[model samples]
Target: MRTRHVHPRPADPTSTSRRTMFVVLLLCVALGSVLAPGLEPANAIGRTSPAATLPSQDDGSSITWSVRPSPTDADPERPNFGYDIAPGVTVTDSIRVRNYSEETLRLDLYASDAITTSTGALDLLPAGEEPTGVGAWISLDSSELAIAPLEFVDVDFTLTVPADAEPGDHTGGIVTSHRTPGVDDGGDTVILDRRLGNRVHVRVDGPLRPALQISDAEVSYTGSFNPVGTGSMHVTYTVTNTGNVRLGAEQTVTTNGRLFFPGRTVTPEPMGELLPGNSLTFDVDVGEVWPIGRTTATIELTPIPTRDGDVFDADTPVESASVTAPTMPWTLLASLAVLVGVAVLWRRHRRRRERREAALVDAAVREALADTPNASDGSDGSDGSEQDGSEHDEPQHENGDRDRAPDGTGAGVGGAHRSGERRGPPAPRGNEQ
Candidate 1:
């Protein structure tokens, strides 16, 4: 040591132990500052937590949380927050989030559009999907939030319907999610996210059309050979929602004769929910006694209101379609065939009877002609006077008989005598001269 005043070795300011102590104090202070506010008794928060519960990844314990519309909000049902707004208008709403867990929790908040699943159940879009409808129109005050143990927070959001927004029911949700730390599964770190939300039903006021159409109505009949027997009938049709609003349908399929007389009525299962531009094909099997011949199959569709607080009216518009199908009556066809065959047989019998009667008449005429006396025979004069009279009429009678008989001996005899007259009886040149 220098004999002159040796200042005590200044305490080493850069020592490793001192630096370590400083870092530890800093960490303790930071942790205390973060946890001190939440450590105060839960009752000091002055808000009631929701009854909803969520399961945690650590030890399978449960965490209770909920998102609901603020108490003063319109249509403040817990999970369904509905609003009726006009186009080119802006509306503000708040949702209350509650945490009942013993430890503080952080949540990621977002807005997403609602969708119907393939099974026709309502659901929300997955994270990272681009929002297009109601989700795009919403803006939140806070995108992230932290809640103390047994504490609740209310989040305010603004919804701005564009001037071109479609006039109908648009659905979306306000979602809050908690992402758990990554876990090693199959050499891959998988992070699980749990989410809860309140559904937002926004109805933009404008002209709303409610319409339904029944199309492609077809009826097929498979008939038995026996016309009186029952057969199978199938009716197929398509139901389309052509309007901008959702609708449910009560369908009635009927079969009627010319004057709409009741034949068969079949009421299938109600058409549940039909969204805009959606179509459904239905096939119904109806069994009844279908009258033989043409019948009309008519489909009548009455729309059932799907929205809440709707009044039923008797004059509701109904859509109808019809198709004509023919049922063949084999019995009538067979009877017609039988009648045709009887007529043919009766015609043949009548012709045979006429031919037999003509043959008998011809035979009787020929016998009467053979029994007549021949007035040209030279015989005794006992009946000379009568014979003379008969001979005198015989020539005239022979000419008449020849004209009547197409083939007879009288015509041949008359022809020979005419030839003799032409030769003047051979001029009597025989030895009789």
Candidate 2:
């Protein structure tokens, strides 16, 4: 079987500031010494003590230290301990613990099973916690050590895999701890146990099944108030390492709709190494997305080996999950509602005004028709216009009869002489007759 090892970076002494910190371990009647939340032991020995977190002595002296895999002739720059051992096999290794303080220090050394914190950082089980895996298989050369100031110790240990050890990866760490007396804010005394350790990965020869699962996939949309503007989509899901081997993943999030609206793809940050049974959640946002009523979000994960040279099928199928959500433009709908209401009101007002104008014209025409005299009622000659015409015609015919002579021939030039003779002498009338 081929073997592979992952190398980690060294601890930086100046990574943290120099502040006097303390971890107060509570003494329980049944639990003995129980560690607090922040004081939880870590597995990555690369965590160097910032003199600030270490307890100081009466003389203002503090102990600063670090631990890592012991350097060997074959691999002088070895950062952490890694091994590919078979079941029932025995392997021997060593760790180097260095004290950077001016005072001599006494420390306790032990091994613990590896655990990952809630934030995905690698940690180790507390010293008070029992180990059921590789941590129990290894035996340290010495559990206690007294090192001089600025000096280092190379502690050797042997690991014997159980005859029936399960095949796959088993992780743990070798930690160095030092306890000192400290005063709490209440003027009470407490013991501060400072720890530093390097991670150990032991992979037993066996069938490696690298798998991942995506669950609780969900999508939500935030729509814009602007009718023509686009909205944003939020996608959240959890990724779980369901296989025995440590694995990493590359994720691709895609969002699409029913319409030909172009789909959007988002590639979030790469995920860190995930140990078996460990899970991590991711939240991603896709902006500038038009609300097409309904949208589908799909997540695709491609598995990656944390350690190089670790062979698995290259054609492993990609794990995928999908969820759909409604993306309705409620703001736009409200705007449309307001516009429709105004249009309806305007239409009603226009109809009312038109009805009022038609009513006024009808009233004016009725008044004009009532005030005018009825020409159709002429049965009674009491009509003033016809009475006046009859009176004038009668006077004209009587005058014409009085002015004419007895004989129609006596009219004309003799008419004037006959009228003068009747008023004056008979002689003038004889010539007229």
Candidate 3:
């Protein structure tokens, strides 16, 4: 009875075809899994990676630093970075920095633009070495300080409260770096950067400090390392007093050393105790500004009836600069030439001395060779003497590093002595009559 139904089941070719198709599809998926990583992402299949999308930290740029204060004035101990300063005042702030890189880097500190170009010292600092801790620069100081790798240091900056400094927040930043710094990304060019800036809110009460005025403060030749009569900048301060008491105050100013101005000490004068409504205006010279791009100082002020150091506090910063004064090629070349000359001269001198010593040994060795082969008495004394001579062999000189012979003559020893000694015993000296 079951035989009739069994004979009806024919070969299902459609089912076999479907099974084969599924197996082929599975193989393709498995192959893709192995090769997918080598293939580009959907969006990047035909294009190159965008530079913006890539990291460009220390690829080739130098490392720079922009130390910022705690954003506020709960503590005004930072150099030139303080709180509300009166129109007639100055303040000082300090910053700490380090080169968190493998190679050595230099750190330079500077201030930048204020309300007006003339408002703060905008001296240009020359490329110099990095610093470790608190350091100062001025228009008159050498631009050759340096900061070693993996080392940190402090830098002091001053904030100037112009006798007529504008009332309200004046903002700027301190920039530090090397002419050739190693970027954070371990690049070839200078790229390391640290920036710390704050907002300066100056309030000037017409009576305490007034005049919405401006004054020119000049810091002159500060140190012994200037080009005689060079390196000086004219700074203008904005004065504003929006307080109740006739305000007497202190302020700190900062600038770029070497290129801007440095040696930042500030001086503030009283606009007199206003009857809480009257205002005063004037200008006081801070100190010498280094030839940096930024310069600043701190000065203390006492209103008609004020106390010492308890004066108002704030900072006057000259924020930024246009790419106007690029360092001259000749200047850079000159510096390079000097460095090369020093290095070359030192090397040449060393080579010259080495040659002279080598020649003396060559001559001595030749003589020893001839004597050793024939002499029958190869005694211990002779051997000891030769050893002593070898130990003492050096470029002989008479009191100085200049190459010389046993005699005081400044000459190389490879050739025969000019005295016609014929490379033999420094001619036996004859007792003169």
TM-score of each: 0.51, 0.75, 0.24
Q: Write the per-residue lDDT of candidate 1 for residues 1-433, one digit (tens) a residue.
A: 0011122333333322444445443443333343322231101000122354444433434455677777674454544677789998999877787776655768888888766544344556766676887889899998898877667788888999999989977877778876554323233334445567777778788877778998888989877666466565789888888876667888888877445334888898888766566677889877774555777778988898777875556776899999888866556567778899999999999999999999999999999999988866845444433321121112333223432223543342234333223211111122322
- Root mean square deviation (Cα) for candidate 1: 20.2
Write the residue-wise lDDT of candidate 3 on 1-433 in tens digits: 0011111223234423545445433443343343322231111100111111111232332232223442235655433332555665556554445444334455444543222122222111222323211112112122223555445455545655556544433333344433212322222233222222222223342333221222334333233233332243333444444444324334434344453323544444334322222233345443444334334443333323332243433342222211112212343456679899999999999999999999999999998987764445565344333421222224433443534457877654444334423343333223333
Lowest lDDT block of 10, candidate 1: 40-49
Q: Residue 114 of model 3: what lDDT?
A: 21
The most accurate candidate by TM-score is 2
Candidate 3: what lDDT? 0.37
Show pairs that collide, candidate 1.
Answer: none
lDDT score of residue 200 within candidate 2: 84
TM match of model 3 to true structure: 0.24
lDDT tens digits, residue span 299-404, model 2: 9999988886876697876899999999888888888999999999999999999999999999999999999888767654543343221222211232234333
Worst lDDT run of 10 residues, candidate 2, spans 22-31
Off by over 4 Å in 1: 1-54, 73-79, 100-107, 145-149, 177-195, 214-238, 255-262, 277-297, 309-316, 322-433
Residue-level error in angstroms, candidate 3, position 285 = 51
